[model samples]
Target: MTAKHAFHLALLVVFMMVAPARAEDLRAVMEADNARWLAAYNANTPAAFPAMYAKDAVLLPPGSQPVNGNEAIGKFWEARLKPGDKKDHTFEIVSIHQDGKYAYQVARWTVVVVKDAGERTRFSGNTVRIFERQPDGGWLTKVHIFNADK
Candidate 1:
């Protein structure tokens, strides 16, 4: 084979080897982000919640106006999550697709909220979240929208 052809073949082989590795790295980052989210929720501190999102994040919860910005999101959670509210939440990642600096994830979530009075309410839903890679090489949710299953 010509030297030019050999060089092209080697480059192709290198790309094939690197592509899957990059994808795996991205998946790992996304999984870590999910874990962090679960931890933040379980921590039950509204102050700890907004750090999981970008400064310009928007949250679209069912039947509520969109909550924009990190501060607003934090306040929203603080208002709804009372001090004695017990929450058990779990997330199952359905799919995650990445493009350049952004990724969208479809996940199924189940949450059980037990009030101070021992009343339990269960909420299960599907959520789609758009995550942007921050300048510091961390992923944060940019847009989060979820609806409950009736």
Candidate 2:
């Protein structure tokens, strides 16, 4: 092939390789996802939270059984939001990383709860969320893993 044609083809390849990952733009999407999590907590609703996860998502806590699937996760949060169960809660996002079709977020979360006998308990944990891109151009959690930082 001619030298001009070869140079043009090379340039096209370089542009295509760099186009998909606009590094600065991913932060916004990550921020929005982090905000969504906090909103779900404030509303005490599991629907939106679990919807952020894939259908076969898996949640691994620091010291507990794995919570599998959207339904079970929804049920767990619904119960946690019941009266005399939990009160004030907040989540602080620490960092987010985006690469191709996957991303991870780290955050610290705190919550106050009341027991059946009216005793109060306060706890906090560091959480890491792993997300995968969906076919519809949305992101969903493929794995939710966290540990108690205290």
Candidate 3:
């Protein structure tokens, strides 16, 4: 083989080895994002919740049409999260994959909510989320879709 060809092949091998390590690092970042999301939901502050999404993000909730943009997303969450309600959220990541500036996660989530009379409702679902790496070197959700496990 030509020396130049061997050099190129070595470079390719190095890139392939480094790629998986980078993906692992991204997985850690996504896990942190999931934790932040749960915290935001528990806090019951709609404003804080939408900050996890990109400015032009979209949310696809079951039995509903798509909601676009952070402002609209915040309003949607606010309507559902009343001031006096208590909510708990748990997320278990099934898988996370990344390609270039984009990554996606499949996770199972459970949420329990209690109302004024201690009436509790529980919902569990599987979710798929698409993330984009922002210019500021942070990750934000670009698309989020989830459905109930019922």
Candidate 4:
């Protein structure tokens, strides 16, 4: 092969090698999802939040019924947002695992809520979220399990 041909072939090979890193890299997907989740909660727009979830999504929230599907999950958040008030909130991702079209991630979170009687309630939890790659090249959450840490 000519030098020009060899150089072109080498560049093609390098591009192919880097395709997966850009296409399905788990870390980037997880980080983006984490940011979106934080934004959703801060916006207090639960109705619009479930659109990020897949059609068959399920949520296992601590101390409550298991919420299934986008509608149910959206309802849960809407109700929670209506509560007295919340503060001292924070969240961070712990880990992420990608397997083909599916992925799972863990996030640590904490929140403080104040009631009418001037009472303060503190809560901490870990959230495990499962995601699936959609046909349209987007990641949608499939399952979300929240467990209290204290």
- TM-score head-to-head 1 vs 4, winner: 1
Off by over 4 Å in 2: 1-21, 84-88, 112-122
Output the number of the lDDT-best candidate: 3
> How many residue-pair clashes does candidate 2 contain?
0
lDDT of 3 by residue, 46-105 (tens): 888678889899999999999999889988888887888899889999999988899999
The C-alpha stretches of model 1 lying farther than 4 A from their native spots are 1-3, 115-120
Backbone clash tally for model 1? Answer: 0
Ranking by TM-score: 1, 3, 4, 2
Each model's lDDT comes to 0.88, 0.78, 0.91, 0.81
Model 2: lowest-lDDT 10 consecutive positions:
19-28
Model 1: weakest 10-residue lDDT segment is 37-46
Residue 52, model 3, lDDT: 89
TM, every model: 0.86, 0.70, 0.85, 0.75
* TM-score of model number 2: 0.70
Give per-residue lDDT, candidate 4, residue 37: 76
Model 4 spans > 4 angstroms off: 1-24, 83-88, 114-121
RMSD of 2: 5.1
Q: How high a TM-score does candidate 1 get?
A: 0.86
